[model samples]
Target: MYYVNQNQINKRLEFLNWLVETIPESLENKPESDKAILFLAQERILHLALESVTDIGSYIIDGFLMRDASSYEDIIEILHGEKVFPSHLLETLLGLVKMRKKLVQEYFHLDRNEIYPLLHELPTTLSEFSNSISNYLKHELNT
Candidate 1:
């Protein structure tokens, strides 16, 4: 049997919940005068949400003695392999992981046109991710 840190996972989930709720408002209320600030805010929100997903995945992988993840992509692959989330989301999650990398590494050069569509889609993706994690935890840990 493996140990899972339910409390830690729960805390991350709670934060994700907040991010999910905030995404719609943030995207909807982007002011013409504050476009730069709104862009940064959107980027930060995406970064935080992606980070939380990886953090939670790391926690579960570590707790369950899953093979070591060599990269963020590996973390998502492992979770998918374990059936923690649906197969349909595998590609989307991988894309998000890549976006996370770009957000961190190439923040100065990101094209707003490219990112705007993603910002619009993020809330649904995050909601699905959060639900998957919750369900996986409940089923695996009997919580």
Candidate 2:
């Protein structure tokens, strides 16, 4: 039998939702116009969102699935290995892991252009993540 820490997962979901709301829908004209503040804000928010993603993955795998994941990318792999995340999301999640690394390891000379696509997809990506987790939990609980 499998179970989840629903409360913990909900908190992560709430934080992810907040990040999605904070990020801009489009950065076409905004990044340049605002320059310093907006760019830094966008970068930080995107970094936080990626953090939230990994945290959520870790929460699920460790707390609920009772599995140990070695690294940020391994979190997603562990979830996938347990059939929590669908096949389609694997690629994007890996990309997110790399982005998280960029934000953390590559501290200096950050580029907004590279992070833009992830920000743009934050809303939908998070929605999919939330739904997938919810659906999995629901199935596990019911069975």
Candidate 3:
């Protein structure tokens, strides 16, 4: 039996949704670069979104899966092992983890173009994550 932290998961999902709502229709329309404040806001939002992703994984692995995963990829893999996450998301989540590392450690002089598409689709990815968790739990509860 798994003991899930639905509240925390939902809260993280909510925040991600909020961030998504704040994003403009297209990043392509912006100037080659953003103004100082715009850059700051985008960076902050990315940081929080990435942080929430890790936190959600931690909550599940620690609270329900009861496993200690040493790294971000490991966390995802462990959850996958438990049939909690689909295999298709493995590549994207791993990429997100790498991007998070880059954002945290090498954010200075980073290229926005590379990150633009990821930012654009972040909401959908996050929503998929939330839905995956909800569906997994529902299936477990039913079984």
For all predicted structures, in order, the TM-scores are 0.92, 0.84, 0.79
Candidate 1, residue 30: lDDT: 54
Q: Name every residue pair that clashes in candidate 1.
A: none
Select the stronger candidate by TM-score from 1 and 3: 1
| lDDT winner between candidates 1 and 2 | 1
Clashing pairs in 2: none
Q: Give the least accurate 10-residue stretch of model 1, judged by summed lDDT.
A: 22-31
lDDT per residue (tens digit) for residues 1-143 in model 3: 66677788778877877776776643435575655556666666677777777888888787675579998777777877887777777666666666776688888977766666667766676677767877876786673
- CA deviation > 4 Å runs, candidate 3: 25-28, 31-36
lDDT of 3 at 47: 75
Indicate the residue-level lDDT of 4 in model 3: 72
Give Cα-based local distance difference scores for all models. Answer: 0.84, 0.76, 0.72
What lDDT does candidate 3 reach at residue 6? 76
